[model samples]
Target: MRKVMFAMNISIDGCHEHTHFNPGEDLMDYFTGLMQDTGVIVYGRKTYELMVPFWPEVAKNRTGRPCDVAFADAMTRIEKIVLSRTLENADETTRIVRGDPEGLIRELKQQPGEKIAFSSTSLLPRLLEAGLIDELYLIVHPVLVGENKRLFDNFLVPEKLNYRLEYTRLFKSGAMALHYQKSE
Candidate 1:
């Protein structure tokens, strides 16, 4: 079975607003590496809309820094699954899935593939509650955005979910990449 990995960038204060922090070259490279290793990426409607046109355009035009371009290229190569009830269509590489995201992910895990990555903050709570995430990568940035949606804003698990830290890397930008595996 493929491992389900949940990755996101968060502020020291737990804010998950993407625009709040600018990822440096090292951080961008880190993300690129993650994308390279992932076979499939799952996003919510909001994240898919924010990423698709922008990343695909970047990949096509080869704009921005080298790291950015590489990250965009990697993003464009991966298969994407968007879980949204209202989204009617997506690009060729993406599939718009409606209803029962948990079930869909569960089914995906049973199939042979590389790691499945989750990139949507809105769906994090649901995924955690369902105990579907096998690994987690939290890129904790140094700065704090005082007022933004937090990483666990709506997470209300009945019991604690445990994870063991498997790896940690600190970038020059002061952001730290923390990799954790779900504890047995």
Candidate 2:
């Protein structure tokens, strides 16, 4: 069975907004590798809307930072599963799932693949609460936004979740990529 990984960019103070911090080359490369290995990328409606138009265009026109372009190209090629109640349609290559998002995700995890990469912070809490997340990969940025959405704001676990620290890499920009596997 494939593992479900929550790959998110978070601030020192736990903000999840991408606009809150800048990702350097190393960071982009790290994510690009992730996007390449991901068999299916899952997103919430808001995150889907935010990414749909931009990355695919970058894949076509090949504009922006080299790392960004590469990441975008990889993103364009990955399969996308969008969880939404109101979203009627999505990209031609993407699948729009209405109810039972968690069940659908479980089925995806059981399927033969590299891994299911979750790209939406909005759905993180729900997924984590369900004990569906196999790995938590957080690219912790250096900046601290005193006011903003909390990274684990939506997380509501019945009990404390324990994870084993797999590894950590410190980037030149002072950001660190922390990788952890959920404890059995």
Candidate 3:
């Protein structure tokens, strides 16, 4: 069976609340590695917009230090499907798909290839409610905020995860990489 990896950058208190996209280098390297292994990448609408513009152009003419270069490079080849009601078009490599979101995911799980889903907090909750996720890779960050998106806040159902500690790493910037496998 293919694994659906829910990799994200969250707070130290298990809160994914963030003001803006500031995923660190360690986290980027880690996910980029996983994304390299994955043949397909599924992302939420917000995530798509945040990530799409920086790709394949080496941070889109931004001077100085490169941000997520591996991620930009890897994203060019990996097939991406962005789930959005508002997004009308995608670039040459990607396809903008509109439909009942979960219904589409349910169908993808039955097909072939190693698939991975990025920070679709909205969709992840639904998948958990449906008991469909096979694996999850979450990266815990250091900061916390007053108003931002929390991964499980909008989740409708409670899930008891039988997970295994796959890997753990501490970054110099006071971040932690917490990898969990849904054992059940």
Ranking by lDDT: 1, 2, 3
In TM-score terms, candidate 2 sits at 0.96
Q: What are the runs in model 1 whose C-alpha is more than 4 Å off?
A: none
Question: Where does candidate 1 have its weakest 10-residue lDDT segment?
Answer: 117-126
Q: Candidate 1, residues 1-184: lDDT per residue as tens digits?
A: 9889998899999998889888889999999999987989999999999999899999999999999999999999999999999998899999988989899899999989899998788888999999999999999999978998899989999899999999999999899999999998
Query: Whole-model Cα lDDT per candidate?
Result: 0.92, 0.88, 0.72
lDDT tens digits by residue: candidate 3, 46-118: 7777677657566445432443666777666788889888887776777777877777677777788876664
Candidate 1 has an lDDT of 0.92
* Per-residue accuracy of model 2 over 65-160 as CA lDDT, tens digit each: 999999998899989989899998897999998878789888998799888988677777788888899998998998888887998887778999
Cα error, residue 150 of model 2, in Å, equals: 0.4
- Candidate 3: misplaced stretches above 4 Å? 14-24, 59-67
Q: What's every prediction's RMSD, in angstroms?
A: 0.9, 1.0, 2.5
Between prediction 2 and prediction 3, which has the larger lDDT? Answer: 2
